[model samples]
Target chain A: MSITVRIPTVLRSATGGAATISATGSTIGEILAQLASDHPGVQPQLFNEDGTLHKFLNVYVNDDDVRYLGGLQAPVADGDEVTLLPAVAGGFA
Target chain B: MLTLTSEQRDAMVAHCIRNLPNEGCGLLVGSDDGVISQVVPSANVADSARVYEIEPKVLLRTFRAADDSGEVVAGCFHSHTHSDAYPSPTDIAQAPDPSWHYVLVSLRVTPPVLRSYRIVDGDVTEETVTIR
Candidate 1:
């Protein structure tokens, strides 16, 4: 299945400034893997050494957060749009 | 520099004040020139006075709207309940977009202080915030 991944501003450098890119996969993990493979710099940003989704990153397939859709195991279909956004978080402490 | 209308600035302060005790957060929608057209208040999903997280749904919706409007999610703002208007260590560590203006509102003072910064690769640089 072909999917479109929307690249956030911070990750644009890794994608050669492309705002959106196309990849093929049936699940979120596969799509991300293909993304990292195409853009090696994105690998470390998207996954941890243990291959878990980075805690600070949010992945959405369409409007649904993948975390609520079984995380990396979330299934996707052709023409699905996957968006990666850095969790906007911070504190005084 | 980050430029915002005075009313936009007040809206951010008001949202932070409304979420008192817990930190407030929001997204900034604007052009590439740093002129903010909208200040979108969001729920601090973290719900902690010391920290904040922009609700995911808000983020998604803001991004979609910006995409459709030809504007961009230029940056974001959050409140510092007890500290000064500066990027905290947590803010630096989690600074997502280097091109984004990281705005902070310090409610510790009367008439809450608002400031903006550019955090890149963990380095924080204070920027001028123009509220007209």
Candidate 2:
């Protein structure tokens, strides 16, 4: 299955400034792994040393957050859109 | 410089006030020239007085809208209920987009204060905000 991954501005450097790219996978995890393989710079940004999704990065497959959709194991169909947005969070702490 | 209409600036301040006790957050949609065309207020899903997270759904919709409209998601704004209009340490650490204009609104005083900055590689540099 081919999926479209929308890269956020922060991660553009990893994709050579491309805002969106296409990768093939049947699951979110596989697609992300393919992305990391294609763009080594994105591996550290998307995953932690233990291979878990970065806590602050939000990944959505077709408008629904993957965290609520079985995380990276979430199934995806061909043409599914994946979006990566870093958590826009901060405070006066 | 970040250019906003007077109404857009006021809308941001009003949204922050409405979400009192918790930080208010929103996305800025604009053209490539840094002139904001829309001030999209969103629920601070974090729901904390000390922190904020723009609702993910809102963000997705905004990105789609901007793409459809040939605009861009320029940046975002958040209100600081107790501190000055500056990016806190946590803000610096969580700065998501280096190209984005991080706008902070300080409500520590009676009248809110708004400031814009470009946070690149953990460095914060204030930018001029022109309200027309």
Candidate 3:
């Protein structure tokens, strides 16, 4: 199946400044691996030493959260959209 | 005294009340399966405090805690103590994330109205808010 992954603004720099990109995979993990392969610098930013999703990162399959669904093993059909959103820590005056 | 397990919800209301003078804000996470444990806050940003802004760092920390415990961004919430429990133009203009709900706890005293909404792309859709 094919899915599109959206990279939030904070991590855009690792993706050559691309906000959205596409890949093909059956599960969230596979799709992420493809994403990092497409954008070499994003792996370190997204995964930890053990290759698990960072504790501060959240991914949504369509409108549902993957953690609630199945975490990295969450399955995705063609045309699904993966939104990788990290916590925003900047303070507004 | 007979009581049910409404302590959390009640505490949320109380938190809103106590933080009423500074636009108190916070996030909620947890609940397996159906996506519950949402976030809400009552604003203390009175008419004169419009110039101030929420601390994103605080929100980020809450989000991190939620993520660590396997929670979605679920929703973002803030209070409308000075006005109705609805998204204002400024709220839309300043909305940073597009995937969460913006719960509003209006503390107008005369009549308290607590509401929830999904503000995405500048559009606000009211969600069902049951005080349970």
The TM-score that candidate 1 achieves is 0.96
For candidate 3, the per-residue lDDT at B83 reads 69
Alpha-carbon lDDT of model 2: 0.93
Q: What are the per-residue Cα lDDT tens digits for candidate 2 across A11-81? A: 89889999999999888899999999999999988999999998889899998999999988999899899
Q: For every candidate, give the share of true A-B contacts it also has.
A: 0.83, 0.87, 0.00
Error of 2 at A48 (Å): 1.6
Runs of candidate 1 exceeding 4 Å displacement: none
What C-alpha lDDT, on a 0 to 100 scale, does residue B10 get in candidate 3?
57
Candidate 3 interface RMSD to the true structure: 8.8
lDDT of 1 by residue, B10-109 (tens): 9999999999999999999999989999999999999899989999999999999999999999999999988899898889988888889999999999
Model 3 clash pairs are: B20-B44, B23-B44, B75-B101
Badly placed stretches (over 4 Å) of model 2 are none
Top lDDT model: 1
Q: Candidate 1 chain B: minimum summed lDDT over ten consecutive residues — where?
A: B88-97
Q: Tell me the tens digit of each residue's lDDT in model 3 across B85-123.
A: 777776765555655555565776554566767667788
TM-score of chain B of 3: 0.71
* Model 3: CA > 4 A from native: A1-93, B1-6, B31-34, B38-48
- Candidate 1's docking class is high
